[model samples]
Target: MDLTEQPTFAFDVFSKACPSRGTLEHVTGRWGALTLGALYEGSFRFNELRRRVDGVSEKMLSQTLHALERDGLVHREAQPTNPPRVDYELTPLGREVAERLLSLIHFVQGHMDGILEARERYDTARGGR
Candidate 1:
């Protein structure tokens, strides 16, 4: 009966349930990372996002935008004009995540040689050299 001795869970503010696994999947998603990176440059419309992230299908880009918006990491604006212009930007929270992701990209680019060497070693070990 020593409830005070138990540790509190930050994720279980409402109850004992932890954060949903979908959260992780959303953040680490293939297009999600790239979307954040693209948005970091500035606000862009849907087509612009699609253009910046080459090879991303329209459906996938839409899904990624929805997920980011749901997570409060992205801001979506729609104008009721003749053509109806919509733009997407990063929220402050998103900027934090984007900066971290940018740093990761820089790190990977800087260490690409080491990564290539490691891949070569693995390929040789697998007799695929």
Candidate 2:
């Protein structure tokens, strides 16, 4: 291989040392998932994203955005304006990921009633702990 050539890596998320694990965590984490799902709708300003994600704190949203941006799953655009507008949107990769996540989200939502019943049964069996 040429000295200037970069080595290709085959990443496996199951490996403890794999970098993909970090990206997976970022994409699947509570705030990260919520943030990505919100961005899937369309581009949103920082405050708008915060509002869309609902329960996420400003600090958490900022951190989640930073992680997603670092992972190449989100794009942050800052405009030169009086108020300094900043917008967040999903990259193509981000959109692809969001599409998959949305499928899971919909599946869980559709089965929520059954899930609740299962949970109730489990709780009752465990003495309502």
Which candidate should be chosen as best, given lDDT against the real structure?
2
Report the C-alpha lDDT of model 1 over 1-129, residue by residue, as the tens digit: 587676755564345455645655676688988899999999999999999999999999999999999988999999999899999999999999899888988899999999999999999999985
Mind giving the per-residue lDDT tens digits that candidate 2 earns over 1-129?
898876666886777999999999999999998889989999999999998999899999999999999999999999999989999999999999999998988999999999999999999999997
Alpha-carbon runs more than 4 Å astray in model 2:
1-9
Clashes of each: 0, 0
Q: Please give the lDDT score for candidate 1.
A: 0.88
lDDT of each: 0.88, 0.94
Estimate the overall C-alpha local distance difference test score of candidate 2: 0.94
Candidate 2 weakest lDDT stretch, 10 residues: 5-14
